[model samples]
Target: MGWLFLKVLLAGMTFSGLLYPLLDLSISGKTRAPKPNIVIILADDMGWGDLGANWAETKDTTNLDKMASEGMRFVDFHAAASTCSPSRASLLTGRLGLRNGVTHNFAVTSVGGLPLNETTLAEVLQQAGYVTAMIGKWHLGHHGSYHPNFRGFDYYFGIPYSHDMGCTDTPGYNYPPCPACPQSDGLWRNPERDCYTDVALPLYENLNIVEQPVNLSGLARKYLEKAVAFIEQASTSGRPFLLYMGLAHMHVPLSVTPPLENPGSQRPYRASLQEMDSLVGQIKDKVDHMAKENTLLWITGDNGPWAQKCELAGSVGPFFGLWQTHQGGSSAKQTTWEGGHRVPALAYWPGRVPANATSTALLRYCSIPTVELLESMGACRLSAWTITRPSTLLGEPKLVMGARVLSNSTLPLSFSTWKTMLQKLRPYREEAPSTRRCCQRSPGFLQMSFKTLLMTTAPERTTLRTLR
Candidate 1:
């Protein structure tokens, strides 16, 4: 009887494994997620090892650990670039910084920023009738044409760039003194620009200067409060909303609540991580209470940890490198190494994405375009059948090969290879199947530009550019 029971249990497991997709599709029945809300909580410079779910030895980041256990975690995830501006540009546009012309962070004095023409994720969702709000850091662009308000978000409450930028001469902050960094104590008016100008860090609320040199202590909590308020406002307004919460903790000059300072971790960075974890938990709890079934939540980091800060920088997980440089051609932060670009990605949607399941499938920040495309195809459904059901060509072998090329091939390691893959797949989305097949069949026929190869810089460590 025991042997028979064991056999029956094995059979049941096998049956469920095979039948799960069919059962799900049958129950869902070609239905789209009506009025589904989207929320993305992005942590700045938070490492994979910082979460208790990913690593056992972390200082009990309970909120993020709970998030991973409740959602689907991607073990092999990556940011589009290693730096703030480029990674963020990739996140919004579904393209690389090289393609988007945002290769580095914008300088304090210079007005450079992400190009205005590139489409952002917020823009796409907003076009699909979703109310959008961006709370926290907006590092992609700070200048006139490239600001968040102009890009897509309906409401923006965040700093123009990294908090570390525009460093002040204030005590306890050891930033390099800059000659042209607007040195002043109180608010000063730039009459020609018609905006408040100051040496201190400026915080903006929809193009207006709200605070300069925002108090570092309890800043993360303030951001969380703003996000919760925005969620409440958007929910009551009778419109689906997209809340992009780009967290500023764990970046630099880390601060934490007094309660979090001693009980869990004596280190400031650890305390900051603890605070961030609780903040995420609060937001997720709000979502669960309001719209668990109708909301899709994603939590991830912009890039790897800042290794230069030693004990204060956090861990890099099992990847590679410590600080800016490591042996074996591996590096962190500013370089193209896996340690630099790879970050955590977790997605949660009750009754949609499989709970507690992990997908090792490689994902890029650039695939956000596919999300936009899926949303544009009508009612959005978060399942495998959504793409396959709408388009008959996804199952074809040639298209599968194209998909495999994008997923499995080493071609995407370089920017040129990524361009080749995109050039081939763009047709698949455009309904030009013949063109896609032609492109896929002769994938190797595409010539690699010598200049592109020459332009590619080998990953190496240099002087630390920014604290972030």
Candidate 2:
């Protein structure tokens, strides 16, 4: 089953690459323009409800909401994985954890990152003559060859891992509130606090450590400055560029610039969210000024908020995952629940993407369609397909008709679907021993089945049903 799934995933990626040019030609008309600059802004630990446009109760993301209004919003977009490293690896490689060899978060002291053999999106774009730069958190690998520079990013800036992973001069606002790094050479250990205080967080510029024990308060400003400069430089050079900004806004140890209007009224998380949104707005403005008609700005989160952070974490909105919560475990961040994987996604391209549109088609990280979209843009080739009508690239929900459905009597389904199916089969709350065992082991089983479903393609409908 594993081997078959791997082959299907590889085939899907290859097929997507081939189909992307046709989709691109359908949008850009008969005369093709230069390759579009791609700006992908990735939020760390941001929830599906964090974007104000997605959920009404949370009103911090003004700029992001504006972006959504002027672009296409995806309601059913999901991260490749629930955790950090694996999700990031999948995003860059267009492969799952099983194929990418990164199933969990990489440690600060970890020697390896995403395996060197795997090709990255940046690498592909770079090969196609695009300038690639990555700013912000890069948790894939920090050591020698596993670094972003080695991974095909022309230039790299920001922390090697999560901000909270190591102690810094300005620790910012965490749940328990971590202390500042000691001035003395000796490492500071707090028996009461669970946060790290020994090694200081280092800020990187390319391969060099520009700042040790980075000032959390000033980091946002620095990131904005660097990102804007990169975009301007690349635009002036007349080369299509790929700028991947992995933001640190919605994550813990929230460092927010104080609001001028009301200093003490707002929460820290909301303040930080506003700061993040403002930074995005500034970047967007820069893109508009330099290359509005030829750049695609895509924004999304790595995964859901860290539920363990309580008030500090972002809201998950409707994906509360009540079934898991009833069993006394978190359904956010590390779990396979909707709250853990479902994230807010927006795509903005002034004349290219349809404005104020929403798509409900189910999508996950490293999906064939996404890969096709990126490769189509990066490859910069137009297909024989003629542009007859105005439409957005991946702006509408894609329907796959006449496909096969493979299922077992106890099929692995989505959380909501699984609940309905389970109730029809047997009461989940009061289940027999065999049923309980099946339910306990269904998360991983379901994920595998879901991937297979996404990759399967055929001429005629075929149902593979088996009795367990």
Candidate 3:
């Protein structure tokens, strides 16, 4: 297995001090104080250039730009995988697609999901007494036990998969525009063009279908309302919470509200970007108002933009992947090129993460230090040998963080360390029969190699290599 290692340089006080309260309590065998809340906002198919802070040309993400100024922005952050299901699986499990058994997009008819046995971050937090909620685009799986509600989320609201995967009452703008669902649907097919017209996109609230063929235009507002409500309720209940919002914005079939002045003047993608930014701003405002002091707000994209969508797709900024593009095919989204997985990331914790700080260290969504930080805060109990303290990177701005990617022949060396525990939790299988196809090794899985990234900052540079 080959893993991409990125060095993370966090500019702030010693991270240990930030969690001293919880660590001290754990060591002294005392009841821990209130734990800080955690909110992870994941954008669907959003490109690295979508954030105005990351790309000067992107003016739509005003709220996100302000967030970068108020927090630490990572210049070399990446998603674990280049696609949806695998990326999301990695985020929640802190494991790559190989370990989590999700390496591709799941269909609406997928009989399985992220595997019922895999322990999710939500489950760990829930067990630690945190109220966990997931709002928007639960693409892991929608079948029976694989649903979000069964995956340890106390509340779930969103679509089963990507918005364009099914027909909706009002199909949003696209490069090749998609039509609305037929009023009386009896296997409505569009053979001339590539689009889903058979199944109706269903809006889910927990296990129940709130609305079949969801109104794409109004979905973003609904997500915002539900997110705010959950935050307020969890805050009032006096419990720390975890809100994992998987936004549908920046994805295909862009459902953006038209501007009042000129409805058709702005490009649909830019308009949608603005709408997404506004939604993010609202959510951030709610967090600031209710739990600004003790909450950590982290935002990043699941993967790169879907380049096939052309004008409707987001921007990849300067990660053009000339080497790959020169050959043939797209280097975005489904590919393992830098443009496919390298995403923009921002971390905000009012008094913790330094404001306006930029970290050049490479970091991936799958093995973020936040998981270790959460563990230190009594979120979950992992084996002592496997625990990496957040304090390790206190003064080391160029420290390399390593993780293993799935390969065809060999399992990760670290997998042996986790094997026993994983087996104890659930029977270890080489691959699940239902999702075996989806669990194939990543395309980039090959022998390890050394690759150095030259930092733009003067006199400070780091060398990175692929881990195997």
Per candidate, the number of residue pairs that clash is: 2, 0, 3
Writing each residue's lDDT as its tens digit, candidate 3 over 353-406 gives 666655544431112233223433432212211311221111212212221111
Clashing pairs in 1: 201-213, 307-323
Model 2 has a clash total of 0
- Candidate with the larger TM-score of 2 and 3: 2
The digit string of per-residue lDDT tens for model 2 on 1-468 reads 999999998789768797577666787655445777889899999998887766767678888888887876766567878888888887777567876798989987799999998877787667667899999999999999999999989999999999998888877778788888899987679776556787888999999999999998889999999999999999999999999998988888988764234535767788888899999999999999999988878888888899989888988866666557768877689888768887888878877766765554333222212222333443211121111122232222121221111111122222222112212244323133222322322333112122222121323322111100
After superposition, the stretches of candidate 3 with alpha carbons farther than 4 Å from their true spots are 1-31, 258-264, 364-468
lDDT of candidate model 2 versus the reference:
0.72
- Point to the candidate with the largest TM-score: 2
The lDDT of model 1 is: 0.61
Return the lDDT, model 1, position 17. 99
* TM of each candidate vs. truth: 0.67, 0.74, 0.73
Q: What is the per-residue lDDT of model 1 for residues 144-199, given as tens digits with 9 covering 90 to 100?
A: 87888988899999888777664322211111212233454555544443122345
Give the winner by lDDT: 1 or 3.
3
- Using lDDT, give the best candidate's number: 2
